[model samples]
Target: MFEVGFWELALVGVVALVVFGPERLPRVARETALWVRKARTMMASVKEEINHELDLQDLKQSLLEQKKLPNTATDNLNQNILRRRQATEILAEQFEPGEAAPEKEPHD
Candidate 1:
């Protein structure tokens, strides 16, 4: 996002060299690079978590709307069964074998 020209970078380098001297400049630069990398990774994780929370809110809103629909008892029962089956299938798709599944209640 920074639009630093070659001259600006050269100026920064000159200043750094004068302030740190030849002996400590390389170590300072290495530490600066590590800090920049860690900041970038932390920002990415924060963005990902925010997006996940927004998606979860959207899903909850849609589920509430689904339950508010006017329908007969038979239609409501069928829709709930269908919804549960869809949820189970979604969970199954995310798992590798048995690693991701939750225990289900036994249906008689």
Candidate 2:
């Protein structure tokens, strides 16, 4: 930003008065103020839009991460279930069709 001090502002005002003249200076200054106000409003609107879009991006990213976590968890659960089923099948194979499985020894 430009660091315009009080003297610089006075100098610019004197120049503007000389250039624009007394009759047109007030109108010109008013119009300039209006344009500056409009520019500030437009900049604020654009800044708000950018922040909103960034928030949405963050939300979407978090949702995607959450979605991935559940899928990974589900996949792990399925894999564990499959492993257990395989172990159960192996155990079943150790017993004949009509034979009972051996009783397990209790842990101390």
- The most accurate candidate by TM-score is 2
Candidate 2 regions exceeding 4 Å error are 99-108
- Give candidate 1 misplaced runs (Cα > 4 Å): 70-108
lDDT of each: 0.93, 0.96
TM, every model: 0.63, 0.85
lDDT of 2 by residue, 1-108 (tens): 579999999999999999999999999999999999999999999999999999999999999999999899999999999999999999889986899878999999
Give the C-alpha miss distance for residue 37 in model 2, angstroms.
0.2
Q: Count the backbone clashes (under 3 Å) in each candidate.
A: 0, 0
Q: Looking at model 1, how many pairs of residues clash?
A: 0
Model 1: residue 21 alpha-carbon error in angstroms:
0.4
RMSD of each: 23.0, 4.5
